[model samples]
Target: MAKVEQEAEVRYANADGLADALRGADALFVWDFLSTAVPDAWHAADRLRWLHIASAGVDPVLFPELRSSDVVLTNSRGVFDTPIAEYVLGVILAFAKDLMRSYDLQREKRWQHRETERLGGKRALVVGTGPIGRAIATTLRAAGMEVSGAGRSYRANDAHFGTVYPTDELSEHVGSADYVIAIAPLTEQTSGMFDRHVFRAMKNGARFINVGRGELAVTGDLIEALDTGQLGGAALDVFDNEPLPADSPLWTMPHVLVSPHMSGDVVGWRDSLVEIFVDNFTRWAAGEPLRNVVDKDLGYVPTGTSRV
Candidate 1:
């Protein structure tokens, strides 16, 4: 499309520019990671035959018109899992060994030889069984943590589903674990799941890692938890709002680390998204079985079992 007369239309400045081009496009590639609220999404949606989101999560883009369409929908499932998993493990170790504290003390020229703990032997309960959650579980398990994962469908007695449980009883596993990782998808059930009660239930000094949606953890509740020593610390990559609003109290908290959600950023990120699209596009155009096709009825459910 870039080589043709549509070359000028193909150039993009951002979501606005890309959205402008979508008006005439038969298929739309929703690569914008920000939560877009384009009221006129249905304008192009009418002509669209397919919509592919570059980000793993799609709840932000699932509009009424788009959702009701017969257009095949997909997401970038396996692209950022490894990078995010690596960051989760790094934060886990950093919290366990008081690396951040050591750095702070060293900055003031203070000599402290504190016997810190290791990530090994700590129990971790990943709240979601999504690709990112599974990736975190596998990486944490490799680091010697007793990792367990649960989603909406996991069963306790099912021996074949080892180290995995159902999402129904998150409070049961979450309260006792040394680490509580929330990679759960944002749904009606998960929006404010990590409220005051949830935070109060977590073991004291237990670190909370959230690479998932920001709303998964209530902002005020998290602040109270950190201030009251209910949680040791937090490493937040995502937020309820982007750039996290410069004046947000989370930025000033000593026990919390605020990041700009750069966990999935890689040198080849754009090329990687394009590569995955090209592979799937070829199959899609050929009328063959498409890969990464989302389960729309269940609202962007990622099975992680690849069609390829």
Candidate 2:
């Protein structure tokens, strides 16, 4: 508020009063990235010109009305890239060193020792060639792992990504990877892309990690893969359903690690989000092009574009 204090008036609204609040509002800052209220309240947005979401993926706000409207939609993309990349590396190291087992043994007062897998020479098949995915691949490579990326199209020997295979080639690489990571956006083509066929194609004992949208993979198929030993384990940060229903078997699975969709969040993340919004808000108010403006039709910021 301090940055735009002189130019704009800020109004607060929760889900219950959102529709009414949207009336005559020229700009909206959706602090609750997960809220579905924006779409429902969109009808009341008589003066809305710009809508800013404080998150990377804009799936939650890509309702048909907003998609067809002139309202400028923006997201906080670059802020979470490095933090999420670091999270992926931390989890990969934890799995390789069997840190979970060490903690379990400590709790039982058993001083047992075991051999761990070497990260070097391991292969990682990273889906999604966006900034976040690229960051993950770079970090994994720095840690001595061989990484290959898959995206909407194939590129040969790009500067950041040596070779990015098209999505069609993903199945071919699944069976050869020690780690299969999904970080793609939630889109028509990507929804449920990881199913029985893809899971069955994975190398036996190979681990799976999803820092992307949950709907990208079929939960039931993943469970079956782990149950049948087709997959060694899974580290899931997102799920088909948020909060992952208490009775979901994944919570108790010995080989599975479940987190509440927080891979990209680090200390002071909320403040960072606010900062991004404030900067964009300043631009919006001045009738200048905004940062992180999403390609509404594509559902994300276009590649090779400046984010901030």
Clashes of each: 0, 0
Q: Which residue segments of model 2 deviate by more than 4 Å? A: none
Residue range 238-273, candidate 2, lDDT tens digits: 998998999999998877889999999999999999
* Tens-digit lDDT track of model 1 for 1-308: 33222332343435565556667676666666564733355565446777777888777876676677798888888888888899999888888888898999999999989998877899887887777887888888888998777678655642222556666666666777888888887776788788888788889888888898898889989989999999988999999888899889899897787789888777897888877777776666677877788777665545745632
**What is the overall TM-score of model 1 with all chains considered together?**
0.90
By lDDT, the best candidate is 2
lDDT of 1 at 234: 92
Least accurate stretch of 10 residues (summed lDDT) in model 1? 2-11
How well does each candidate superpose onto the true structure, as a TM-score?
0.90, 0.97
Lowest lDDT block of 10, candidate 2: 158-167
* Structure candidate 1, residue pairs in collision: none
